[model samples]
Target: MLSTALAAPAAAAAPRYQRYVALGDSYAAVGTLTKVRSAPIGCARATDNYPSGVAARLAPATFVDISCGGAETPDLTTPQEVPLGVNPAQFSALTPDTDLVTVSIGGNDVGFGEIVRKCAELSFGDPFGAPCRAHYTAGGTDVLAARIAELAPKITAVVDGITARSPNATVVVVGYLRILPPRWGCWPLVPFAIGDVAYFDGVQRSLNATIGGRAEAAGARFVNPGLTTGHDVCQLPGKKWVEGLVPTSLSMPVHPNARGQAHVAGLVAAALSQ
Candidate 1:
């Protein structure tokens, strides 16, 4: 009986999810989707985001979510000032004892916001003429490609920092969700030229490839979501994981919605299990 009692205590001592930290930009930050309430202030974090979803599924002992909107690679090391409050450097949330870490970043670093904005603005002139693509490649140089190349080193640095800060943590880098439809885009909903849709999709693919490659090289697991099959923003309202340019719900255009968050959380959980 004494031996049985001692063994029970030993089993109970096994650590579960001791600590988890999520970091990144709007994609990582969960926000309102179809009027669903989440974090009320800075970062617009939603309670139903992948971090939160993972926590619920894994029941981590401790979880901290510092993801913010408009975050760049530098924001991982520097403070970010948002309307609700100032978000500390994302890496600040990490410690050697951190058990798990997940980040979905780098899009903003590649000037995605500017690209989208420019695309939207140029769409008005010629909805079917690929004006956005022409504008970006006006000088026969792909500016966006240059931006991605510039950010590659930064992403590597981030992965190195996370490894340095939490040497034992299971670091998972999440990739961006698909934003364009397969084959054909919903012109009225996304407003991008037919050619521009393919162009943008190619850019996203490039970003994902870079992120996946960097994460693998840094000894971290990468979750690609593999959502491109049929879960693009142009999918039917309920089928889409990412919202279109003109959101059908309260979700921000080009961002993931609740379903998307849940889907990513599942992917993260699966990765952890492996």
Candidate 2:
């Protein structure tokens, strides 16, 4: 009889959770910082953006940034109105096997930009304050309750859907970075009433709260930069992450700049590591 050698069992490979996908709006897109490329895989699409920053540190196998400028919650699940060069297609890359996913949205849905634009032009000279609070609470035209109510469920659905699609993936919902000081008396730079600044901040805070609550319910992570509130664009030059009303350039208004993006990415990486 010939002696036969038994074959050794094969070694199991390490679990691979290296794919990272980023989904969100102009804040995440960093449209103003760089030109967007048609390439599906490369940081040619706003390489300086926060998600890109995170990926650079993590170095995942695949980094899919389906983030579009001006994308809202509904835009993630359905086709949306498209402006030139902006992608409106809903994100479909995230699946049950996806490794990691992060989103930064809901600002457009609540028309927060409009508030800032309007407030940026307000004059509080005579009254020592702008009509910011009145404009927000008048309940007929400028009140945001309806918009907030509508946004709550829509954003919740997006988070829940993402969780269902990527049960094992680490879903992280990032909150909006601050855009103004807590009191907003930046004068010509911000050019808004202190009350208006407070109102805008309140809106942002409320939106972040909703996002945190929803993400918690979906068993995902919610990262808020609430601690960085006073360090917004209205702050002195070196202290701000976002730009003021009159931007240093034609980039996204009141959004996080490169420094801001770095801070955001650092926070996100820390969260994912945990």
* C-alpha TM-scores of all predictions: 0.91, 0.84
Instruction: Give candidate 2's error at residue 4 in angstroms.
Output: 22
Compared with the true structure, all predictions reach lDDT values of 0.83, 0.73
Residue 30 accuracy (lDDT) in model 1: 59
Q: What is the C-alpha lDDT profile of model 1 across 208-230, one tens digit per residue?
A: 88888888888889998745568
Error of 1 at 160 (Å): 0.6
- lDDT digits (tens) for residues 1-274 of candidate 2: 5334446556755434577889988778773456555543222247778888888988887888888766778778765555444354546878666788999888888887787766665544513475766767775665676677777777678877887887778888888887766675676657777666676677778778887887778677988865576678767666678877666643556777777877899998898788
**Any residue pairs clashing in model 1, and if so which?**
30-46
